[model samples]
Target: MRKNSFAIGCACFLVFALLRYPQAMLEAGAKSVTLWFQQVLPSLFPFMVACGLLLRMGAAEIVGEWLKPLMRPIFGLPGIAAFPFFLGIFSGYPMGAKITASLYEERKITLSQAEHILSFCNNPGPLFLVGTVGAAFFHAPFWGYIFLFCCFLGAIATGMLFRLFYFSKSVNDFIPYQKTPSPSITECLPQTIADSIDTITQIGGYIILFGVAVEAMKQTGIFHFLGNILSFLPFSEEFLCAMSGGILEMTNGTFLLSTAPDNLSFRLTAACMLVAFGGLSILCQTLGVLRNVPIKKSRYIAAKICNSLCSGMIFFAMAPFVEKYAQKTVPTIAFLAETAFTIPIFYIKSSIFFFACAFLFALYQRR
Candidate 1:
């Protein structure tokens, strides 16, 4: 009864705001639509379609078989987890959670593993991090590479940390994995495209609504109030405002940070945190996709918060190097690959070693 009343009240407030500030709402909606049509649709649609096709083609089982050894020991997850991990990394935002829910619904992964994977797999795609953020926002593709590496580093850390403390009774329960049918490409292409369209449309709706919500918050002074609350943090006014915006939505927050008259290091740190956290808008999108699956919202929220902090720390540590490398003018695929590999190798290997040691310790204790 209380929940229903709260939702009703919120809806009424939104309607009132829309009527009160029609211009702001309209502009916000237009910008969001443009962003979705130009950037989000092009980058995400093909990946979504590809992911749907891969799963439909039984790619999970195949990938799982190959990845089982690495996944089990390091992450304490099933081999099937690779499906979401790689796809989520490549596709970015909610895809990881989306795939996990699908796997759970299909009985490919148990509930606990689904929850565990949620901690780290979902992230912003390379295109966004490198092209949109690095080149477009910061005017330095090198920082984009730094952000990508740090963001992924944080994710990897979150996974290992979660595995260390995770306890579940069904961790050892073996369930027969569902084998997805490998239909002909021509046969499955239409359904896959249809499903991808539905998914992207839902994402588009959320983006536009959140865009309006941000404008509404601004018109009502709520956005300023939120920013004012964080003034004690030693950051500039612009930084505080950007952070507040980021708490509501990721892209908006990062754009604010990029435009703020602050040092590059501070902006980089804050952007990493916001991107990793993925904002309330992203949380809603994840919830929408997983609506049919029974997963704990609280746990997902906690994981995102942890991930943000982890990524922020990484960005801080690497800020010096980023500043040193900020002058790389000719940013290309080779440079990105080279930078990603060289910079994160030490951290990645250390994390893997630490997790492997912990896994062995767990085995010893069990014995």
Candidate 2:
């Protein structure tokens, strides 16, 4: 029965792909496919290699230990879960999902903890916000970092809330920490680079496919059409667009938010919320990672709702101050403030960037 269901699902996907974008599929012959493969390889190669080094060096274990006390109180999760939890916050979205999946496979965490972690685990990494969204998209590093801070606060609040309500159980359920002996820097660095490359390469195809799909959707005016309809609703236009982009592809969605026309306050608020939520694209990947785990979608959905509510409230409360104080200040001052907020987060392993790197490393090292 499961085999038949899987076959049907694949068939449906192929049919949908063919029907929706026949031209792209047809023109996406050998050359286009090869080109896509080549384009994504370099970026993924370094990432994979880096992942390997982190694992071999036992960086993940070190970070996880560092994060145990903080995570235990806030999310009712064990020390081991911190690796993925932090990874999600620093690396963003699917990276967290990937790490969570790995932990589950390794029997390092229980299903309940996995589900709870997934709720607040999805986050946009600092690099994405500061480099891509801030520098490239918004052209304002200060505002970008401020928004990232807001999102982080929101994620923490949401995780705490979930811990208070649904996960009131004792921490005994958490797996006992097992220390992995670290390799020497000399040996570890080369291995890390190689592993990062391998993991990145395997996941590279998905990233490119997702990126192309987003581009194709943009070219087809899907976002515009949806934005037009959503604009009529109560929320801000930027919010609607951000939500749409998030549902399709998190990176593209964030990119779109950076380009949206509006006040910095409003744009920052919406972007923060989107980043906190980790977008629908990330959710899809999370589901894939959790497939073998005994996780429930309902619980995950509830956690997301909690996260959204917390993030939304934070964004609203911060908007006024950001506009009045931060906006009038020089960009340098603003950048410094934002950086101050982000610095502590960078060291904290629970952020999305760490999660992506750790998960990639874990996946690469899995026997």
**lDDT, candidate 1, 23-137, per-residue tens:** 9889999999998897789878888888888877888888786666667666878778878987888788878987888788878887878888888888887777776677666
Using TM-score as the measure, which candidate wins? 1
Please give, for residues 314-361, the per-residue lDDT of candidate 2 as tens digits.
Answer: 877866755543322224322112332233343244457755764555
Off by over 4 Å in 1: 4-6, 165-171, 174-181, 328-367
Considering every candidate listed, which one attains the maximal lDDT? 1
Instruction: Report lDDT (Cα) of residue 153, candidate 2.
Output: 72
| Cα deviation of 147, candidate 2, in Å | 2.4
